[model samples]
Structure formats: structure tokens, C-alpha cells
Target: MKLRTWGFYFAEAWRGVVGNGLMSFASASTVALSLVALAAIVILGANLEHMTRMLEAQVQVVGYLKPDFDRRWSDLLVQKVRAIPHVTDVRFVTKEEALDRLRSELGPDSVLLQAAEDTSNPLPDTIEVWVDKPSQIPGVVRAMRESVTSLDSVDYQQEVVSRLAALTRAVRLAGAGFIALLLLAALFIIANTIRLTVFARRREIGIMKLVGATNGFIRWPFLLEGMLLGFVGSALAAAAAWAGYRWLAAQVALGLPFMPILRPDRVLLPLSEALVAFGVALGGAGSLLSLRRFLRV
Candidate 1:
């Protein structure tokens, strides 16, 4: 289309919005609210996924050696553990190092060390095994239990690992279902809003048809109007979501420093772009669908 024709379409769109001020506001508000909810879910799902991955990376299996197990065999044991399928790394922790770790954990209280100085260290040697992936941890642990006869105990945070895996799956499934619902709701609302606008202009539309104007020409203004509404609403939603996420991230940093929170730049930037694209697509689709019935006239 020519620049003048595009300009005319935009002007007509603006007039339509202004003419149906209340409906336009309602449509924009609906878009804003839907996009806001969608953005929140996206951010939350992303953060949860990040947290899950962090937890998985930290997962390890600690195999405690029997009390009488010879320290010289530590290297051999490490090699054997590393040979296990899916085991990515293995480190042997001596009894003495375990005692020192205990001391450090106990803080400045040297009394425990001083009392045990005369006695043989009761702390057992440990082999720390890291797997290629978190899901492999359980299998690796089972293999260790079966192959390492000298193991006094095999341990890992089984409960935490299982819960994290379950949580990740739940978040993904729930997020998908929720986003689908929101998209459908937004489509329906926008389509209904545009339908009302078309209904109100029925007489003008008939006159335009009588004057030999094509349906495409009549359709462009409403399409542009819907897209404009979606763009404005999504912009507002993105701004609000970004501010809210930053505030929440700061709060999490202060209150729960150990917890992993996704940075805004890494997550929000992509999310904002996605929201804008979604809004525009949904707006255009809704307008096109609503105009079908009117165009048949």
C-alpha cells in the first residue's frame, strides 16, 4: 500500500478507537491483564527451571568407607567409582579431612578437637561421586551400594533430588496449560470486543459496500485498531512485570541469598519481546476472525 493509504488506515483506526472509547478501554484492559498473568507465569516457570538445574548440578553421592578399610585403597576405590557408567567425577575425602571439615563446621569450638587428639579419628573416609546428570544420581548410588562391599553407608539427599525433579515437571505441565487457557481467553475477549465495534458500524459498513469498497479495505482499519490496542496493553504489562520482577528479585536476594534467582536481563528481555509478539499476533488473529461474518455481507 502507499504511504497515504497506510496513513489513512491508521487515522481510521484511531477514530474507531476514539468512537468506541469504553469498548476500546475494555479491550485494552483485558489484553493488559491477560499479558500480565502470562508474563508472571513465564517468569516463574523459568526461575523454577533454573532452580531445578542448580539443585541438580549440586547433587552428589557420598559413599562412606568401612571403619577398618585401609586408607591406601582410596585411590583404587576412586578409580572403580569413576568407572561406573554416568559417573562424571570422583573425589576421595580422607578421615582427617572429614575431621577438619567437622571442626570448621563447629566454628571456633576447638574443645572437640582437643578432646579427640589422643584418640584415633572415628570419622570414616568418603568417596564423593558426581554424575553426568541429576537423574543418574540414583542409579549411580545403587551401583555403588552393590559394587562397593566396603562401604559403611551410601548417602545422598534422595528426598530433595526427587522433589526437585517432580517440581520441575509439574511447573512445565502447569505452565503450558495455564498459558493455553490465557491465550484462548484473550482471543475470545478481543474478538468479542472487535465484533461489537463492527456491529456499531453496520450502517457505515453497508454504505461502504454500496460504494464498491472491497472487504479488505474495510477490514484494515479494525485490524490496525486491534493491533494497536494489543501493543499498548502488552507494553504496559511488560513494564509492570519488569518492575515487579526486579523488586521480587531484590527481596529474594536479601531474604534468601542461597536461593538462585534468574537475572532480569537474561529472562525479562526475551520474555518482553515474546509478549509483544504474542500480543500482536493474537490481536491480528482476533480481528480477522471477528471480521469474517461481517465480510460475508
Candidate 2:
């Protein structure tokens, strides 16, 4: 398409919006609201998944050695765990360390425990294994159980690991479903709004048809109009989402210092770009679909 022709289409599209001001505003608002909802869900899910992965990194398998197990075999087992793929860190905790930990945890009862320390601290020497990936847990556990020379029992937060995995899957499924519903709603609203625009200008379209205007020529203006509205609406939604995320981050920092809650700049920027592209495509598709039935030429 030539620059002049493109300009003409743009002009006509803008004119259409100006001619039907309230209808156009309503359509744009519909698209904006839908995009905003979709973006919010996506941002929330992304940040949460990031935080959960961080939490998962803190999860570890504590392999307690038998009381009679040799210290050499325990050291060997710790080395083997450290060599496992995705294993981040493995530290051997002696029975003494465990006893000390227990004592500290008991607080006021520490003095009594110290007095009876000769009763044989039943705590076993253990190895705490941490991995980079959550999926590595089962394999690491199996390897330690089978390949390790000494391990009485492995104690890990199985419930937490399982629930986190399940939660990640649920979040993905729910995010997809929410986005689909919002896009569908946006399409319907844009189609109805554009349908009215086409109806109000039915006579003008008939005249253009008589003047030898092709289908492509008639379609371009509506498509461009829809795309323009989508772009503007998406920009507004992105701005609102960013501001909301900033506020959320501040609140998290103030109230939950220990919790993992970083600003979502990396996640949100790409998502905002995606939202703009998706919104434009949806609007153009909806406008074209609506205009076709009414144009009939």
C-alpha cells in the first residue's frame, strides 16, 4: 500500500471514531478493561511463581544416619549428594549440632537438657541436601537411598514440595482460562460497537459500493480503527497495571520483609508488550468479522 493510501485509510478510521464518539469510547473502554484484568492475573501469577521457586530452593532433604553408622560412610554419602546434578549445597550435620539445635529450640528447657546430656543424645548425624530444581527432589532422594553407603531415613517436607508443584500447575491453567475469557469478552464488545458504526454509515457504504470501491478498500478503514483503539486501550491498561504492581511491591516490602517480593519490572514489561499485540490483533479480527456481515460487498 502506498503512503497516501495508508494515510487515507487512517484518516477514514479516525473519522469513523469521531463520528460515533460515545460508541467508540465504549468499545475502547471495553477492550481496556478486559486487557487490564488479563494483565493483572498474568502479572500476579508470574511474580508468585518466581517467589515459590525461591521458596523451593530453601527446601531440602535431611538424611539422618543410623546411630551405629561409621563417620567415614556418612562423609562419603554427603560427598555423593553434593555431586548430584542440580544439587546446590549439602552440609553434614553432626549429632552434636542436632543436639545443640534442639537445645536452642527448647529455650528455657535447654538447662535441663544440658544436665541430662550424658543420657546419650539420640539425634543422628544427618546430611541436609538442597537442589536448584524442585523436580530433582525425587531423583536425588532415590539416588541417595540407593547409591549412598549410609542413610537411616530421609526427612524432607514432602507435603510442601507436592503442594507447590500442584499450585504452579493450577496457576498456569487458571491464568490461561482467565485470559481466554477476557479476550472473548473484548471481541464481543468490539464487534457490537463496530457493528453500530457500520450501521450508522450504511448509506455512505452503499454510495462507496456504487463508486467501485473494492472489499479491501472498504475493510481497511474499520480494521485500522479497531487496531488503533486496541493499541490505545492496551497502553492505558499497561500503565494502570504497572502502577498497581509498584504499590503492591511497596506494601510487600513494608509488611513482609522475609517474604520474596521483588518489583515485577522484568516480568511486566514483556507482558505489557504482549498485551498490546494481543489486544490489537483481537480488535482487528473482531472489527473485520463484524464489518464483513454488514458490508455484504
Candidate 3:
């Protein structure tokens, strides 16, 4: 198309928005509200998954050796533990090292450390095993028991890890479904918005058809009008979401430093881009779908 024709289309689209001021405002507001909800869920689901991964990393199995277990066999026991299915890595801690860790955990000024320095360390040699996933902990622990007779005890946070894994799955499933519903509602709302525009301009459309204008020519302006609404609403939503998330992140950092919320920079940029894209696409699709019935003129 020539620059002149493009200019004409844009002018017509702008007129469509400006002529029906109330409907345009309603359309943009609806789109903005829908996208705001979508953005919140996306940010929340991403942080929840991040926290799940952090918790997964901390899950480990510790196997303590019998008091009489020979120190020479430590290397052999480590190799056997590493060979177990689902075991990703293994580290052996000597009795002395364990005692030193306990001492440090007790702090430099603690009376417990003073007493421990003069006495024999009662801590045992232990093997720490890491797995790729939380669910594999039980199998790995069972394997450790059957394959290594020197194990005086085997332990891991089985209940907590299990619950966390289940919760992550539920959140992902629920978040995805809710996001889809919100987008669908946004799509239909855009369609309704365009329907109102088409209804208002029905006489103009019939006249254009009578004058031998092609359907494509008639379609371009409405399409642009829909996209314009989408762009305006999405821009507002992005700005609002960005500002809100930034404030929330700062507040969380100051008040609950231990929470694993993602930084705004890590999440907001991509989230804003995605919201804009989804909003525009939905508007274009909704417009295209609604114009079909009106185009019969």
C-alpha cells in the first residue's frame, strides 16, 4: 500500500476511537484490567517455581557410619554410595570435620565449644548424598541401606520435600488454567468492543460497500482501531505492573530478606513485553473475528 493509503487507514481508525469515546474508553479499560491480572499471576508463578528449585537444592541424605567402622574403608563406602541410582554427588565428612562444624555452629564464645575441645569428638564419619530430584530421596535412601552395611542411620527431610513438590505441581497447573481463562475473557471483550463500533458505523459501512469498496479496504481501519485499543491498554497495564512489582520487591527485600522473590529487573521486563504482545494479538484476533459478520455488506 502507498503511504497515502496507509495514512487514510490510520486516520479512519483514529476517528473510530475518537468518535465513539465512551465505548473506546470501556474497551481499553477492560483490556487493561484483564492484562493486569495475567501479569500478577505470571510473576507469582515464576517466583513460586524459583523457590521450589531453591528448596530442591537443599534436600540431601546423610548416612552415618557405625562407631567401629574402619577408617580405611571410607573411600570404598563413598564409591558404593555414589553408584546408587538417582545419586548425583557424594561427599564424605570425617569425625573431626563434623565436630569442627558443630563447634562453629555453636559460635566462638559458646561454653559448649570449650568443653568439646578438651574431650574426644563423639561425632561419626558420615556420607552426604545429593539427588537430582526430591522424589528420588526415598529410593536413594533405600539403596544406601541395602548396599552399605556400615550405615548406622540414614536421614533426609522426606515429608517436607514431598509436600513442596506436590505444591509446586498444583500451583503451576492452577496458574496456567487461570491465565488462559483471563486471556479468553479479554479476547471476547475485545470482540464485543469492536461489535459496538461496527454497529455504530453500519450506515457508513453500507455506503462504502455501495460505492464498490472492497472488504479488505473496509477491514483495515477496524483492525487498526482494535490494535490501537490494545496498544493503549497494554501500555497502561505494563506501566502499572512494573511500578507495582518494583515496589513489592523492595518492600519484600527490606521486610523479609530471606524470601526468595525474584528481583523486578529479572521478571518485569519480560513480563511487560509478554503482556503487550498477548494483548495486541488478542485484540487483532478479536477484531478479525468480529468483522466477519459485519463485512457481508
For each candidate, what TM-score against the reference?
0.84, 0.76, 0.80
Best by lDDT: 3
Model 2 misplaced regions, further than 4 Å: 63-77, 80-89, 93-126, 131-155
lDDT of 2 by residue, 1-297 (tens): 789999999988898788888878877887888888887777766766776676677647888887788776666677788888778899988999988877775664566676659688877888898877666788888888887756789877656766866776787788789778878888887887778778877887888899999888888888888887788778888888888888888888778766676566876788889989987998898898798777775
Q: For residues 1-297, could you state the per-residue lDDT of candidate 1 as single tens digits?
A: 789989988997888788888877877787888899888888887887787777667637889999889888888888889999999889999989988888886655688886766688877888888888766878999889888889999888656867877887787788789778877877877788788878888888889899998899999988998898788778888888999999999999888877888998788898899888888888888899899877986
For candidate 3, write residues 1-297 as lDDT tens digits.
Answer: 889989988998898889888878878887898888778877887887787677677638889999999999988888998898889999899999988888776668888777877687777898888998777899999999999998999888767666766777787788788778877777777788788888888888889899999999999988988888888888889998999999999999888877888889989998898888877887888799899887875
Candidate 2's C-alpha lDDT?
Answer: 0.80
Candidate 2 weakest ten by summed lDDT: 107-116
RMSD of each: 3.8, 5.5, 3.9
Ordered list by lDDT, greatest first: 3, 1, 2
Cand. 1 TM to true fold: 0.84
The TM-score obtained by model 2 is 0.76
Candidate 3: residue pairs that collide: none
Which model, 1 or 2, shows the larger lDDT?
1
Q: Which ranges in model 3 have alpha carbons more than 4 Å from their true place?
A: 64-76, 94-126, 147-153, 157-162
lDDT of each: 0.84, 0.80, 0.85
